[model samples]
Target: MEVIRNLVQSLVIIIILAMFLEMLLPAGQMRAYVKMVMGLLVIIAVIQAVGSMARWSFEEIPALVAGTGDGGGQLPEILEAGKRISARQQELGIEQYRQGLAQQVTALVKLNQGLPLLDVEVSVESDSGSPDFGQVKEIILTVSDNPKQTSPAPGGTEPVEEVSPVTVQIGSSETPEREEAVPPQAAAGIVDVLTNFYNIQPEQVIIIYR
Candidate 1:
């Protein structure tokens, strides 16, 4: 649609320029009417372009209103909540909390990019000697490209193949007695926060579990 409009605008300009050229040359009465119509169209095109550039057209008002209206009063509340959380973290000298929040944000970004949960991780800890710094535990999730499948054998029985599924694991002191299972959503959230902390896009991340 945009391409079509641009083409139309270019054609209008060309027609107007052609009309002006014809007027400058020796022309008949037919040229006079053509020049007048072209001049009017040029004026209209210029007005449309100016209006579009300024976003002053009435048709766009609804979209503008909708954009601003969706959040309504909720935007302030959300911002305030974020600010309060930030202030509290600074006040308490809790760096781990900030890290956790960052991990959560990364997870959200990963989810938006449609990355698997196994590609994400989260680390949280309590402050030690330093009032601000904390010992952190990381939960790493990684997705495996291979998966096990069973296929029919040429003779009789089925043949089995080993395949890999996405896996999530925790890292740090106090490892799970056994491999702990992580919820898909939790894994995704970890990815979200990590992405935000590193200021990188979630889709590009590949985490290796130790």
Candidate 2:
């Protein structure tokens, strides 16, 4: 009877102290996390107190953890923590894998015309599979060129060069297609170069000038 009373007193004292200390800290996600930890601590303390009184053996712990025994109270919180950790790890792994593929594509693209591959977007066909290069469904490359040698106009002012962003779609259809939207100040030179060099139709080429 005295042990039970002492346990109750201790719990009340801990709660009062926590409440007083918590107010000294700014509230938000940090406060929420603090509360969760405190709750877990309370659960642990109660479980230990009860197990000691009942003379629980170590062998009973697995049954308790699986929620098959009467002492399975903490299993829900443990499962919740496991789920959150697993989800975050999966998110980080997928993003890292995608970035690695993009970097490899960028290096390979730089070999063509010595121009920069501004960005590469890749799509995978399979909804379920171990991530690998073979699952790639299509790749879109935003190709751009290096600055060229320019001369001043006869009037002593240099002509502004127009930006033509060529969007290339690869492996998306029966034949890979290219499209370029013409800017108001159209720079047909790059579009012409891509179309003629690649032996593709002019319409397959799109020119976006900026």
Candidate 3:
């Protein structure tokens, strides 16, 4: 009972003293600092009073209040962790956006049933600070020519053709083999559709035939 009474009296005295000091201080940044300090002092007093009542030693109270323990040392680690989390989230968002864009491209290309679309690849800018961040950089479409095949007569299987390998001379003058080119007329519709719908250039949409 006596300890409680004394604690109450001490708190009242500290509040009254803080009010008096606040009145004497000028209205400026320093006054705000003083008020903060006074508030800390009041908190310390309450903790001390409680510690005494509980018969607990508060020898490290000052260090804890000053943030000189593990709290201060872990500040940089906490900030680094936050940055890593933010970067991972950005990467996930970019991946999801790329996947969704690829699906849309596939759907648009499929609208032209003449072209057989094998796969769709979408490229996007990953730099968050760039002006074109998250924008589609390019679209690559893999397509195949629908070759016509004659059905076997009745139940007879088709005969397979033999492919003979030719020997190459080491010093012979020969032209290098090139990839099969897709006709412009064949891919022009796809390019126009993508360019007009995505607001991208015709060159940005590449078509590869297999």
True-structure RMSD, every candidate: 16.5, 19.8, 17.1
lDDT of 1 by residue, 1-210 (tens): 564476578667766776666667546767668777667867776666656645533444333333443334354555665666666776566555655554664456455543333334444445454653443345444643222222233375754444445456657465435333344575466557655665545653445422
Candidate ranking (TM-score, best to worst): 3, 2, 1
Write one digit per residue (lDDT tens) for candidate 3, span 1-210. 776787788778877887887798878778888888878987898788777766522333333444455334354655565677789899999999999999898778667634656678999999999999988899998875432222233467863433435667899899567434445675898888888988898889998766
Index of the highest-TM-score prediction? 3
lDDT of 3 at 50: 73
CA lDDT scores, all candidates in order: 0.52, 0.53, 0.73
lDDT score for residue 194 of model 3:
86
Poorest 10 consecutive residues by lDDT, candidate 3: 145-154
lDDT of 3 at 130: 100
**Backbone collisions counted per model:** 18, 7, 0
- Model 1 spans > 4 angstroms off: 1-45, 56-120, 123-137, 140-210
Residue 53, model 3: lDDT of 63
Candidate achieving higher lDDT, 1 or 3: 3
Q: In candidate 2, which residue pairs get closer than 3 Å at backbone N, Cα or C atoms, i.e. clash?
A: 179-206, 180-206, 180-207, 181-207, 181-208, 182-207, 183-209
For every model shown, what is its TM-score relative to the native structure?
0.24, 0.33, 0.49
Query: Candidate 2 has what TM-score?
Result: 0.33
- Badly placed stretches (over 4 Å) of model 2 are 1-73, 124-134, 145-210
